[model samples]
Target: MCKQSGTPLQDDLFLEETPTSSVTEKVAKPGPAVELKGSVFTLPVLRLKRSDLGAIEEALSERISQSKKFFENAPVVLDLEHLETPAEVLDFAALCSLLRTLQLVPVGVRQGSAEQQLAAVEAGLAVLRGGSVQETVAAESKDKKTGEVVKQVVVPSKALVIDQPVRSGQQIYAQGGDLIVLAPVNAGAEVIADGNIHIYAPLRGRALAGVLGDASARIIVQSMEAELVSIAGHYQIFEERLPDELFGKSAQVYLQEMALTLVPLR
Candidate 1:
């Protein structure tokens, strides 16, 4: 009962043919273009010597309060090498949870026993090996009853040498090792190391040494025109123009009494 709706057919002379190639070109698909790559990076490690959680939480809270800027949301590698026994069972889930409550993210665990490794894996933590920082413990006894204290000496890794200039927008980090740059570091570049940093040529960018609380770390430069320089967490920014004596001069920067000190390189 409904009336039919339709367009009138056009005359053969009035009809125009359209090219199919143009339509195909518009709808054509491109080939797959995804690739995988690998790179190296640096991360700080937190060594654990005991399994007690309450004491650890209290101590960690105090430490975090002291250095809020560095501890907040920090990624850490958990080292279990300093424990009295490798076979000692630990509550990996509880440990990770406590760390997270303190804003410490645990990415991996190192130097643990087979069972401990499995527990960490079950807690969604990776097992790490042969990294720049390893087997280094700087933690106190977490056992409330035993009240035992342990100390560990960290042996720094070999120096990382760079023979070419570091261009702008480039970042170089020498984890647990000294960084030696034989060429200049251009502006907008960054050089960081956990031990020490040495530049044989002009340094116009930023240089940070002792990134992991190594107050003994130092920075030596042949021609120091750096925009910023830091030793451990102590830093000094050159807001105004650098002094003639300090700029383009051989200098050595170090930490003294928790302050940054710059002196002539002798």
Candidate 2:
């Protein structure tokens, strides 16, 4: 007998071999990458007087009611340019309370007096100086002049139709397109368009046309009781206010040498 040292070499090799299972091989297919485009909307500032808390609240409420969609998830700058009084002279807490009541999230302030800036900082609001505002405006204007084609295109049209009452605290925007309102635009409501804006009903709110530098844009209203009107970036607050003859009647608003003009719509 061959020397059996308690192990059988070749014969027992089969028992010690590890088992393997067959797996089907599959290849993964490659897909194309997705591209995203940027937004085309621009937000405006809410300018108010320091002592006119009631007016501010009312205006904000009207804005909210007019265009809830636009205001959602939007950033805003409060332009305190109209406030001539020192911030120390006004009640910061009261102002905050009024803002809250109007459902306006005040993130920052611009064009405020020195005392106003301090008050804003104390109220935990960012203060954007006039220089900064001018820089931003200039940059935007430069971008427009460059005429760099954006991924998103805005088509211009002559006619539009809106069949709802625009309430205070609401805003409607039709950049690069005409806007037609078949209902009333209540006080505090804002209507903005880069093209013409036509309201067939009472316009007791704010109207801003040619927002994106379209100097030829115009505004036509069947009934004009507007608190403010703007065209081609130039604005007019009816401090003396438009005459009653202009209100409850047809009117047309336009820009003349960058100035705002309202005339009877014959």
Cα TM-score per model: 0.55, 0.45
The residue-by-residue lDDT of candidate 2 on 182-259, one tens digit each, is 999999888887678999899999888777657778999998888778776666666455787796789998878767
Estimate, for each residue in 1-266, the C-alpha lDDT of model 1 and write its tens digit.
95434443553233344446654345668876986786554456676777789988988898778657657898988888877666897898999899998999999998888888888999999998755333345655445677666554566799999999999989999987899999999988989998899999999998988876678889999999997898865677665667887889999999989889999876
Top candidate by TM-score: 1
Please give the lDDT score for candidate 1.
Answer: 0.82
lDDT of 1 at 7: 44
* Model 2: lDDT to the true structure: 0.72
Error of 1 at 258 (Å): 18
Q: Relative to the true structure, how large is the alpha-carbon lDDT of every model?
A: 0.82, 0.72
The alpha-carbon lDDT assigned to residue 27 of candidate 2 equals 91
In model 1, the runs with Cα more than 4 Å from the true position are: 1-35, 132-170, 174-178, 182-196, 200-266
**Residue 42's C-alpha lDDT in candidate 1?**
44
